[model samples]
Target: MRGLNKVTLIGNLGKDPEVQVLEGNVAVAKFSLATAETYRDKSGQPHTSTDWHSIVLWRGLAELAQAYLRKGSLIYLEGKLKARHYDDAAGVRHYVTEVVGEQLLLLDKKTGDALPPAT
Candidate 1:
């Protein structure tokens, strides 16, 4: 059986998405998402924690993100996890994992924009 690699996230954008156009006019967008969780400790004290994740979108989804998404925009993202390794200009090797966004939904009331499912 084939292994499954999928991820789903509901969070707010940490910053405006960075957009780039490749040689063939293909668009790509990259951004950070912040997800928060609340919990109660044994003493009944409530605490909140936040996690930040890197997100990547391609093609149509990338365009949509660039046009509508911005800092603090709430969204639902469905995608797969991808790990990549690269060497920086300083000759330092770096490994990073990011969510490759395939489907996106704008959950904020202001935009009310929800993109169609990814192809």
Candidate 2:
């Protein structure tokens, strides 16, 4: 039996995608996405909260992200959660978690913001 490790997110980009090319010319893009939720309290007051997630896109998806996505761009993404650990220069260990995007959809309309093809 295998366990499941999946994540789905629909949110706005907090910043432009940071694209990097590795030694083998493989492209990778990283960005922050903000998702907001609103709820009504018992006193009839509405409250809103936003969560920020670290997103990582690889290869073709990364190219698409570099070409189209930007700050405030709306997107829907499906991917698996990934966690990694590394040592810093000070020999301290650090852990990070990110959503490794497998599929992406540009939800923003084509006004000033042009939508890219699905990946």
Candidate 3:
């Protein structure tokens, strides 16, 4: 019995990826992506809403993100949703939900000329 936890998103990076080298020399990158929607309200007034999501990429994907992705860069990401909780130094517990990216595609060819082509 398998339950699916997949997530797919096409959005712009809110900021440059923060990369870190962990134990075993593994690379990890963390960043935020912004997805926006524009809609008309019941009164026919147009409004725009933006949602921010945290994203995590590891190993090769992390390296690629660090190398190419930047703030406001459009990208396609496919991954799984992951939720975790951690206690801070002040003894407060924080819950976080993030996407653990497995596949990444740079979608802004106009601004991504330096990036490798999407495969």
Candidate 4:
């Protein structure tokens, strides 16, 4: 059986999406998202933790993100985790894990216009 690699997150954008076009005219958008969790311990102490995740969207999804999403915008992202490795100028190899988003939903409420459908 093939293994499964999936991730789902509901978080706030840490910054605006950075869109770039590749040599093949492929659009790629990158951004950071922060998810916070709060809990109370047995001793009546409250604890809160925030985790930061790197998110990447390609093609049409990238375009949508660029148009609508902004810093501090709440969003729901569904995707898979991907790890990439590359060598830097110093000849050192580095590995980074990123969430490759396939589906995105804007959760922020709009004032005048209706939100776009999920892509």
Please report the candidate that would top TM-score against the real structure.
1
Residue 77 displacement (Å), model 4: 0.5
User: How many angstroms is residue 70 displaced in model 1 relative to the true structure, after the best TM-score fit?
Assistant: 0.9
- lDDT for position 91 in model 2: 100
Q: For residues 38-74, what per-residue lDDT tens digits would candidate 4 score against the true structure?
A: 9999998999999999999999999988988899999
Q: Using alpha carbons, what is the TM-score of model 2?
A: 0.92
Q: List the residue pairs that clash in candidate 1.
A: none
Order the numbered candidates by TM-score, best leading. 1, 4, 2, 3
Q: Give the TM-scores of the predictions, in the order they appear.
A: 0.93, 0.92, 0.92, 0.93
Instruction: For candidate 3, list the clashing residue pairs, or say none.
Output: none
Give candidate 2's error at residue 58 in angstroms.
0.4
- Residues 5-94, candidate 2, lDDT per residue (tens digit)? 989999999999999999899999999999999999999999999999999999999999999898999999999999999999999999
Model 1 alpha-carbon drift over 4 Å, by segment: 112-119
How many residue pairs clash in all the candidates, one count each?
Answer: 0, 0, 0, 0
lDDT on C-alpha atoms for all candidate structures: 0.93, 0.93, 0.92, 0.93
Model 4: which ten-residue window has the lowest total lDDT? 110-119
lDDT of 3 by residue, 1-119 (tens): 98999999999999999999999999999999999999999999999999999999999999999888989999999999999999999999999999999888899878626665331
**Model 2 lDDT on a 0 to 1 scale:** 0.93
